[model samples]
Structures are given as structure tokens and as C-alpha cells.
Target: MRLIKPVEITPAKLISSNVPETDYPAWLVSATYALGDRVLLDHTIYEALAAVAAGVKPGEEVVTPEAPAKWQNRGMDNRWRMFDDKVESLTTNPGTIEVRIRPGAVINSMALFNLQGKSVTITMIDPVEGEVYRKTLTLVDAGVTNWYDWFFEPIGKRTDVVVLDMPPYGSADIVLIIDAGAELAAIGHTVIGAVKRIGTALYGTSVGINDYSRKSTDEFGNTIVVQRSFSNRAEFDVTLDTSEVTRVRRLLAELRATPVVWIGEESYEATILFGFYKDFQIVFSGPTVSDCSITVEGVI
Candidate 1:
């Protein structure tokens, strides 16, 4: 398995985007926002619960005049949802969506999760060279069990994709494009990270989700379900060289509870998890090989 510790994205690194914030406006310290007015601050949306006077920040506690607390944090801004590190809220736009980035550091791995795009294109262009790298990927997945299923059932699309072995260049213009075929293009999380080869992916790896939706049965034997958000979970084991035990342990300690990408297999999208692991244990049983298991919990 490969580990990818994602870099924190900033406005300077994210050079440009085709999508714009149409609903929410940026918060201004000098502007007096009335009650019920929503504004974007630090990639999050906040609404004024009471009268917000000048110099009162959205996330800060209100003083004297604006005393009873002024702002109510609603959620992440739609334009910046993909960078929020949360999988439930998505950055959506009509038609094709594209983002231009200058990582400002070396990165060789990129992944997209919970996307609604049919096809995706990623490219890198250098200052001197016209195009350094380019690749296009599709989201369709084959699940037909037999001829009957293939002829009767419709094709299904996966929500995630991983691109590895990307050419690393700090000054290159990295562009991400997603085409939804005139439909809405939505992406929940997109990350660019430097790949760290840890071990080889093995079998017995499991992938699924933790359903948080409340469900109950009524007194009359009626089933009632309150739909709520859910999160993905994965448990995977990897086999690695026993010599790298110290480095692996240190890396795991550093990345504990921090959101990072774990790829069990590059081609298997189901094994690609972008979340935090709760606990991990490594066992050195043989002479030159070791085994490690990680249980990851997704961010909702």
C-alpha cells in the first residue's frame, strides 16, 4: 500500500478556477452585515444571527454592541468545498469544471473522491515546456456478473479515481478538468500529495461505509427512516520489508487522526481511502517481511 500525506492548499497555490461563488459574498470587516446575511470566511459560510457591526469578524466573538454572538457558521462554501477535507459536502458546478493549480512543491499523486463527472482530465504544463504530462480517466465501473446482468442492468459509475506516478514539478501549471456531459459536475474531495511507497497491497482488504442514518420501526410495524449523512470506512493490511519498521511507525504516528490518502491498489478505486486511521498494528513475524493493518474512519 502507498501512503500520501496531502499538502495544505492555499489561495496562492490554487491559482485559478472556472467556477465562481454566485450565492455567498466574501465577508468584509468594514461592512455592517444585517441579520440573516451570509458571507464566506476562510472557505466556510457563516450567517449573521444578529446585527453584525463593522470590524466584527464572522468567526470571532462579538464584543460590546454586537454582544449576543453575531455569526452562525452554516457550512463550507460551495466554491471551496473540495478543499474542505470533508466528504459529504461537494463542490458543484454545471457542465465541465476545471481548476488550475501551482502546487509550489513537488507532488506525484492526485485523487478525486465522490465526484459526479463521467470523465476526468489532468494535465501539467511547465514554464519552458508546453506540456509536461497529461492523462484522462473515466468513472464508469463494470459490475455485471453475467450475460443476463449485462443485458438487463444499466452501467454503474464510481465516485472516486486515483492518478499516480504523476511527474513532480514545483513550477508546473497543474490543471484538473472534469466533464459531466452537460450534467452537474460535483466533487467532494480532491487532493494532491507526494507518494510514499510503504508496502505491497495484499488480500483480505475490506471496503464499505458507516451508515449514520437513523432508522426505526413504528408501533404498527411500519418502518421509518430518517436519512442522514454516512461515511466510508476501510480495513486493509499491507506487507512490507521489516527493515523499514522504524520509519513506518514514525510515519503512522505523525499521520494519526490526520486526513491522508491510502491506496491499497492504484487501479482499484474501492481501495482508495482518503481519511484518518484510528488504530494500526504492525507485526514482524518472518525474517525479512512484516505485516501491518490499518482501520480508517471517513470524515463526514
Candidate 2:
């Protein structure tokens, strides 16, 4: 069957320290009636757990079923009456139903449903008290789309410890329908620690500066060094005149540095030169030359 929605689960609140009874409910013990009849309880404990995990809040209503019933043949008056009666009976008398919350914990939401073609029951045994809350539901041939939904009460102030059991059926399947909210709640707890750590780190580093660095090493294990220095005031124009000027130009181009020439105020411009290496002579002959420094950067 396809799941239409996700389950919700929330933290359960502690109600009492006393444990429940030990006996399993009669409905839970004998899932099938005489003549091979099936009794189905629409919801399961696992589904309730899932709802709680998904964040179903207290006082929220969720529907469950008592057993699976046929949905077709609703036009028959007798079938309709049977269906209505069964729904009312199950809703009114959830025999010996009790919710026990574990101490210091939260109570998640509950799940209820009907099982098709199977007799089912629920028995909760509080290990501490050895008391059991037993419940039984019979399967009926109700029309399709007319199944009953059971609403669980709010996870009030008094609930501690929960134990549930279901009897085996020879020919019917027992399915657990859960609440979307409770499922999420259960998963959230599993990763809560990691989420908290990441949140802390993000908050702590919000105002810090981030530094970036890059380095290259040669085959001989020697590291290429590049440096940049800024100079203010002195300026000179240098033109290469030697035969090795081309090689020097190539080397300069490979150095990965920008060359800047400062003219009169508001007339400054920069150019990138490259492809020079070995035996290059640059002649400096500029009227605005007195004392200037060359800044070099990048891997050599």
C-alpha cells in the first residue's frame, strides 16, 4: 500500500512512576474468531511510535482502525448497520486502554487503523506493575472507504512506560500505519548532536577573517618563491634593447605580475608584459626618474 503522508513523533511526557499490568488483552490473544473469521485492528504500536517521532504535538487527534473490513457493498442496509455499529462500539470501548509514558521522556503521538480480513488485539504490559491493558477487535465486511478511525487522547501529564504485543494470525497480514510527524521526531533525535555542533561552529566563525594561500613545488623539492613590494613616488620608464630582450620579456610574462606606469596625476595606467628570458637589457631614460622600486610577485 502507498503511504499518503509522513508520520510525526514528539517527545513523551512522564506521567507516573508506577508500572502497568502484565496480562495481554483477550482481543490481542485471539486475533481470529470462530469459523475462520478475521479480526483486524487498523493501527499498530510502531505506527504510534512513528507519529511521535514525526513531532505530533499533544492534544492532536489521529485516527486508527480496529480491523480490516470490506469496502464494497455499502448499498445493502444490513451491511451499513453492521459497519456503523462496529465503529461505534470500537470507538466507545477501547477495552482496558491505558497510556504509560517513560519517566523523564516525552510522549509521542498515537496511530490507529483497521486491518483487513484479520482479527487483531493490543495488549500493553507494564513490566514494573505486571498489569496488562488488553483490547480485541473483530474484522467485519464493511463497505470500502467506510473504515473506522480511532482517535487517541492527548499525551497528558500522566503516562510512563509502554509495552505492546499482537498475536500472530495464520492467514492475515498485520500492518503498522504511522503518523508522519512522529517519524521526523525520531530521526531528528538521532542527528541532534551533529546538527548542534555544526550550528555552534557556524555561529562562532561568522566574524572571522578567511586567509587564502597557494604554493608550488618543483621536481627537485625546491619551492618557487614570489614576492610583491609597493613603492611610492620614484618612477622610471625602461625599454629593453639587448638581443636577449625577447627571452626576458617571456620570463616576465610567465611571472604573473602586472606592470604599472604612473604618469601625471590622474594619468596612471597598467600593462602586463611577458615572453622575455635570459640576456635582456632594459634601458631606463625617463625625465620623471629619480628613485623607483620594482615589485615582483608569483611563482618564479
Candidate 3:
């Protein structure tokens, strides 16, 4: 029942990057905009909502009372899609994509979802001690069960990566690098935060994906299928000290609608999730121990 309470990495925190933030033209305060016109501002795309809007700065939303509703936010720009919290929207680049961050606050864990790269390199530098941590991970899964799969099947790449061993240093500058050799490098969503251990994930834990594809049958018994993305889901029980019951209740209360990296057991990859929970309950049957059951739903 361990989880990551991620800290929001504002756009300003992304101090440097190899990728450019030029998906659309920069918003001009003097330029005139017609209805449905789009411009980029602060790495976000905003669409003009008026027939003709001039000297109106584009922002995250239509400022009410403060300014006229001239622009409506569409979504993140192409280069900023990975930090948008939506796993289906990918941030892509050729050969490699690199970003540097100074979180200021201490962060010990980082989770990568929907990755499309051959390898990843993470480097951390302390202000006084210099290079503190460096690790490179190959993205392919090497475990093969059968001879046919080993010879005939293409190499399987694990899209999800969880790094739970970062040194807890607030001043360390962390650099994330994704390499795809000669092909494209892409990432869907990334989570960097500190971990919170709730309890152990007992047996009978379940993991699956919720499909959103459309299926219809014609009168003649023919089937039509419209493929769609899916969201990963999981349910598990936890065992924690009875004294932490109040703390767990409060933590869940604060993270109700917020999305965080949920890591049930560090050794179990399927137990990790980055999403919200629909419902949870706590039960106490003894004086020294308590139990918790939580159901989590992930964002695509």
C-alpha cells in the first residue's frame, strides 16, 4: 500500500531541456485573433474563442471578471505533453529527449509510464559533492520462458519504469535522459516525488486494464470493433500498524481526487499505478494491527 505523493513540477521547474517548446507560434498581445485561432503561451495551447480578439494575452483559461473570455485553453503543447498527467498524450523527439530539473524539495522516487525508448539514463548532481548518483537502464525485458519466444519473438520492452532509489537531496540537480538510438524517443507521463509506505500488499491482489473500445453487432451477426485506449486498474489490501490508522485516513482524504504514484510492493511492477482511487475502507480487528483495502483507477 505504499504510494508516491508527487509534488507538482511547475513549468518553471523545468529549467532546461533538449526539446524545444515551439509547437505553435508565440502568442502576441498586439496580434488580432479570430475565432478558433490558436497560439502558444507558457508551453500550453490556447484557442481564441471570439471572432476577433486583439491585445488579449493567452493564458491557462478564460479569466473571468479580470479579463474578457477571448481564449480557451486546449491542452499542453507537443513538447510538454509528458508532464500533462495524461499517459495517452506522448512527448516525442528524434534520437533522444533530455530534461533537467531542480525540484528544490527532496524527491526519492520517479516513475515513468508509457515509455518508448531503448534506454534511459538518470544523473544527479549535488551542489557541493558534485556527481552523486548516476544510473542507466535498458528498456528491454530479458526474461524468456520458451525457446520459440526467445528466437521468433521480438524483444519486449517494458514501458513502465520506477526508480525508487534516488538520494534524498533537495539541492541536487536531477537530469533525465531518454535514448532511442536512431528512432524516435517518446514518453507519455512521468512522476517524480517522495514515497509513502502505507503497508504490505497481501496476496489476492488483482491487476487489470479497463478497455474503452466500442463494439457493435449488425443485424447479420457481423461484429464491428473500434479500438480505444485503456486504463490500468488494481485492488489490494494492506497491513499497517494500528497507530498509523489515523494517518492513513488523513492521507487518503487529502489525495482523494489527486493523482499519485501508487506502489504496492517495490518488487511487483504490476502493483504500481499513477491515478486516483474511487473508494477505500479501513478495518481494525486487533489492537496492534489494522487493514486497508483500496481500489485504484489509472489515467490513460
Candidate 4:
């Protein structure tokens, strides 16, 4: 039996979000953020509590955007603000940044700055609904040089979300055939087999042309590109008993009417072909032996 498996997970240009259901890049600490900046973390968007200083780090117990002292979240007026003036001047005592917005200023966004020397995970609490967004950041060097920007969404809007991309390649795993109609059995089905070979490349599409010699012909019909669906080929080999050979042939015949094929745990919407062993021969040995090889053509 032949099967395909991933030898190594190559680091391709493709990136996946570790965050659940969102593609927002992980937050960074070396970066600088100002008022109204937005970041997606731990399935939530955190606005900068205050305009982070040029060299301040986030997640610091000593330098935090807390309520009443450094940060404020007011539910009665739907306003969340942070007041940390000492952070900008690197001062230990409480001070005020003159640019701080007052109570009547229309709150537009939030920002975060990473002063931590290494990567850190932090959670942002939603001022209104109390929802928590968490995410991790890469090491931000020892100083403050990195920065990110985020505009505020509407009052009730969620953070930016994105879907993951498909894998660039397919594995070479063996295909398993199961009896979909059988009850629990002490042993199992009378026949068992696996696919031996399949296409090495990932699923993809192709294009076609009606004329081959139309290369650079000036006419409109000569320079058109036709799109076509992609196809993948597979081969299966199995040994069976004479009685099981008939059942296997019957199963192959039934596949013609089915629209999907199962290759291990993954299912592909495909079409099957059995031209290779439709008329397989059974040898009469001690236990009537039959060998069958089946070919399949699938549309990906």
C-alpha cells in the first residue's frame, strides 16, 4: 500500500493566524502606538489606552494604562481614556502629557507601545462589553522602534478578521476504502486495499486554447485564454479473495454514481475511473486469489 505524508512543514510565504478566527498580525512591543490605534489580539480589538511614549514598553506593572490613575473606561458616557503623562518623559512620578484629550474630546482610537525587551502576551479588555482580546508579540528588541496603526471602528464593530489560505501542496497519503453500509463487525469488511500512487502537486486549475497556431494572430479570436478545471490522477492496488473480488468490482462500479472520494480523513469532490482492472482475473489457488489495480481521475 502507498500513502503520502508530510516530511516537514516548510516555511512558505503563507502565514496563518494563531489567533482564533482572525488574521490580524500578532502585536509587537518595540512598536509605537498613539491615541485611537487599534489592534486585534486574542479575538478582540484593543484601542490604545493613551498615546504611548516614544520609548515605553507595554505589559509593565510599573507603567500600565490602568483605570482612574493611568486609564479610564466610563460606561455612563461610552468613553474609555488613559491619562499617563509621566510615561512620555520617562518620569517615575505621576505627570501629565499636555496633548491628552479632555472629557469632551471625541474619542477616536487607541495605541499601544512595547517597552518590554522580549515578546509578551497581553489581553485588552473591552470597556463597554468587558470582552477580552489576547495576543502575543515577537521580541521587540531592547528599545522602542517598532510601530503599528489602527483606526477605530464604529461603537459596536468587531476587529478586522481574515480567513486562512489553502496549503500549497498535497500529501501522498494512502487512500482507505470503508464499507459505508456495514454494521459493526468482529473482524471487518471482506476486502481491504489502499491507493498506491497519486499526483504529487497540489490541487489546481488549468487553461486551454481552441487553436494552437494562433500565436500572435491579430484577430480577437486568436488571443483569448480559456480557463479549465484541474484534474488529478490516482492509482490503487489490492489483493482480494475470489468472493471479495466481486464485491470490490461492485464498489468500483458504484463509485461512478458518486460525486466524492475519500482519501484518508480528507474528502475531495471528484470523479473516479476504473479502466485499469475492470476485467481483473482471479487465480484458483488454495484460497482463490485475485489481484486488482484501479485507476482514478479526479477533478479538484
Better of 1 and 2 by TM-score: 1
Q: Quote the lDDT for 277 in model 4.
A: 23
True lDDT of residue 29, candidate 3: 72
Clashing pairs in 3: 88-300
Using Cα atoms with residue i matched to residue i, what is each candidate's TM-score against the true structure? 0.92, 0.15, 0.92, 0.22
Q: Candidate 4: lDDT of 68?
A: 23
Q: Candidate 4 regions off by >4 Å? A: 1-227, 262-286
Report how far residue 54 has shifted in candidate 1, in Å: 3.7
Model 1, poorest ten-residue lDDT window?
59-68
lDDT for residue 136 in candidate 4, whole number 0-100: 44
Q: Could you tell me how far off, in angstroms, the CA of residue 97 lies in candidate 3 after the best superposition?
A: 1.1
Worst 10 residues of 3 by lDDT: 52-61
Ranking, lDDT, top scorer first: 3, 1, 4, 2
Candidate 3 lDDT tens digits, 1-300: 678877677877887888887777889877898888888988889888786556667753456687677778888987788889998899999999899888888888888888998999998889899999999989988678999889998888878888888889888888999999999999998788888888888898899999999999999999999999999999988888999999999999999999999988766778888899999989996899998999999998
- Which regions of candidate 3 are displaced past 4 Å? 34-36, 60-70
Name the regions of candidate 2 deviating beyond 4 angstroms.
1-110, 141-300
Query: lDDT of each prediction vs. the true structure?
Result: 0.86, 0.23, 0.86, 0.28
Candidate 4 per-residue lDDT over residues 1-300, each given as its tens digit: 212211221123112211133323334656677676555433333456677554443333264345322222221100111112111111111111111111121111122211212222333233343423344433322233334222332222111111111112122111111111232101100111123222221333221212323234355666645554333445444455666655555555654533222231122212221112223223333366655554444322
Candidate 2 lDDT = 0.23
Separately for all candidates shown, the number of backbone clashes (residues 3 or more apart, or on different chains) is 1, 93, 1, 20
**Shift of residue 97 alpha carbon in model 2, Å:** 20
Better of 1 and 4 by lDDT: 1
